[model samples]
Target: MTLFSREVELLQLEQDPDPGVVVFAFDLETNGMTTRCDILQIGVKGFNWSTDEGFVQEFNQYVTPTNEIPQHSSRVHHLARDEDGDLVKETDTPGNHEKLETLPIKAALTNMWEWLLKDNPPVLLVGFNNSRFDNHIILHHSKICCEPDLMDRVRSRVHFTDLRTVLSQRGEQGNLESHYNSCDGPPLELHDAISDCTAICWVLNGKAVSYDELRGRAVSLESVLQKKNKSSHPLLIGKLVTPKVAEKIGFITRENYLKFSEEELIRFLKTKGVTKISITLCVKKWRAVSYEADF
Candidate 1:
């Protein structure tokens, strides 16, 4: 093939565009992992792939759950249905039905939908654990908050991107885990809406973690933990799936990662799933960490 042809082929494999585009980073903390789960918080981060603008905001509210949030859930998330709970500050946002500062779920959802639709966006929705959980909650809450048709319109018009699944697929052992428990940081402390939003924002805009640094840490940890081998997982997990394309194996979209030539495949394998932790600890991190942030 000619040089131009070769350049085009390589470009086809890249996920992020050069400039002038943005991605909407999304996350939701829920009461459970099932369809019956209640969404306690919605975290949104907007990242510009082009201009590199990123910002996060939380629309947290107390919901009268159809089912109770389990005690373990309360322990992990502290989302008890307390009449006096600080999930929302009365002065920050007040409404009888657990709305954020001034906007109820429906209104907050509208802001999202409009932001997405009106932006003339070459944008997509992103969530850490969004595929199975965040998307469901967004669909559910949108329906409850607005008409079914409106929700359908949002679903049809807006593209949903799941960062967790992609990160997981690229995992050394097929799972990328967030290390929020140890000395490392994942913005887990606030346990409140705003903090998680910040974390998600940092992640999508490519500000959250780095592989070069993590690899250095992994090498050090191996020496301290007395392990013979350092975990190889962090070196594999990356931004595998792209909303710009169709995903095949969770994060590695069918459009390209699966179609990579042997050369590109090697680069992708080395670069795709290389997260910030070792494979051994990555799995534990995934299992131990509770899913936070709502899409």
Candidate 2:
């Protein structure tokens, strides 16, 4: 739904008004971070910006993959091949595939956006590591699962926040593996989606924050990308728009764009059919993700 004063008010009630009107925090477990990866499940929590405290909502589903769920994925989530498992599993078996109706998850997500709108409030999407991966998965999978176009359409005005960015912005490094070591408490296991997500949430337990990578910010997208490159060995494609930029642009799966040649960039840019000037302005934002740029 669109963000308006009244909508924002109702959202605030749901999220306890952490800062804006409503902020919904969620966590997701997937086979991987690609359109190729199956969306195993999703867990969501909505909070009010004004109050900081919040209520919870959740949606979890298993997908009928067009591809196989890798063994590596199975190890991370600790998802069992059978029921009563500690984590959710990706099954290609006949019976597991027939578990749900047209949409494996009927009540959860399809009706969630509407339920949040019932209050007519502006909602912020918060997640342990979303705003990038999870959000992309939800959008891509919704399409894959043949859900309403309205689901992805809501991106225009959904308030979004992610603890991962906060950690990165705070200059924290290392995978989730490192976070566990630095903490005074126990280490967080990585492949377990909900557990890993909950650990990230612990990082933002007391604060409510929001950010937009596209909008105006103190860090130019280029500069932020460079720092990311300098931190690593600089993979072959890393020289292009840097992994950081790629991730920010919502293609975290691609190592980097540097490996792509100018011809590739041009061919990519050319692939788009001619469109109106107004539409061009919006599509132009993707110029970085859609093409080549490097030091």
Candidate 3:
């Protein structure tokens, strides 16, 4: 299915709030950075500020992984396998207790989706750097688990606001720890998914960022996936080389673009009066796409 882009508007709670809109701050802890990695935990905290609702809904689940959690990842999230090969929470991990019950990846995903869809209001998911990481992991696992219909439902109904992007645009630090500290947010245990979700809520409220402003920056899951796919295209279509630009540059097809070496492409673009900055970006996009293609 093609991605759809539609306008989303969230009303200010103080001015004119819409009780039908629910803003959910969510987070996911994964085994690794790649899409192939398994999600270890999912956490969410939501509110309907229109009704002065405070943390109306909360969800937290630990996902049992099919593969072993790498030491590097375990070091960060404090979830690892013991000598018996059973999943265990590391000692003194924040927000984690000694007793941990985990669900299979599919079950965790399904449960989370069910919880998110329980309410009738339109859902807006807010996360820190989710656009680059957590969102993709969710999408990837959902696809592999044969939950395309659920994912489609989510794409059509739920919206996403990348808190990191919003903060960066406002010239504030984008990383959660830095942003949280800057806003004088309460003590937060950084890697815990639920704790991170709470921190996002705190930062949003501290900054007095209205839901309307977040909605203005929100995007659909489909659009996010589409942008990601476009970036990986051999020609980097819609990213560095649009159709019109490709035609103008005598690189009308992926094959034409691939025919030139990086040096050759840079020289050609220079001849066309492309600035050095644009040329650098073009090369960077090209290399990223090409690198992905190699694998």
Regions of candidate 2 where Cα sits further than 4 Å from its true position: 1-22, 47-67, 80-108, 111-118, 128-132, 144-149, 176-190, 206-295
How far residue 72's Cα lies from its native spot in candidate 3, in Å, is 2.0
- For candidate 3, lDDT tens digit of each residue in 1-295? 1112222222223333356556899999887899788888899998655543235668999887778888899888888766665567877746553646888888888888878876534578999999988887887787667376776566556778898888888887757887778778668778999989888887777786677677778776655665566444323432243335656666656434443334445566677776432222244534632221110
Candidate number of the best TM-score: 3
Report the Cα lDDT for candidate 3: 0.68
Residues 1-295 of candidate 1 have per-residue lDDT tens digits of 2212222322333354434344556666666776546666666665544443355333444333545656677555555554543343222233333323334557767666666667343335665555545665676567578766655455334555555544454451221224232224443544445465555555544533322222111111111112222243222233222323223223333322322333344444445443222112234545532222111
What are the lDDT figures for the candidates, one per model? 0.44, 0.43, 0.68
When sorted by TM-score, best at the front, the candidate numbers are 3, 2, 1
Give candidate 3 misplaced runs (Cα > 4 Å). 1-20, 50-54, 93-99, 231-295
lDDT of 2 by residue, 1-295 (tens): 2212222332334223235433455666666767446556555544432442334444334333334556687666644333422233435563452233213434445555555555554455555555546665665554444345554344323444555566677676555545544553345565554455444444433333332321111221122233334233222232233345344444434422432343443343344431111111122345523343422
Off by over 4 Å in 1: 1-15, 50-68, 83-104, 120-123, 172-194, 205-295
- TM-score, candidate 1, is 0.49
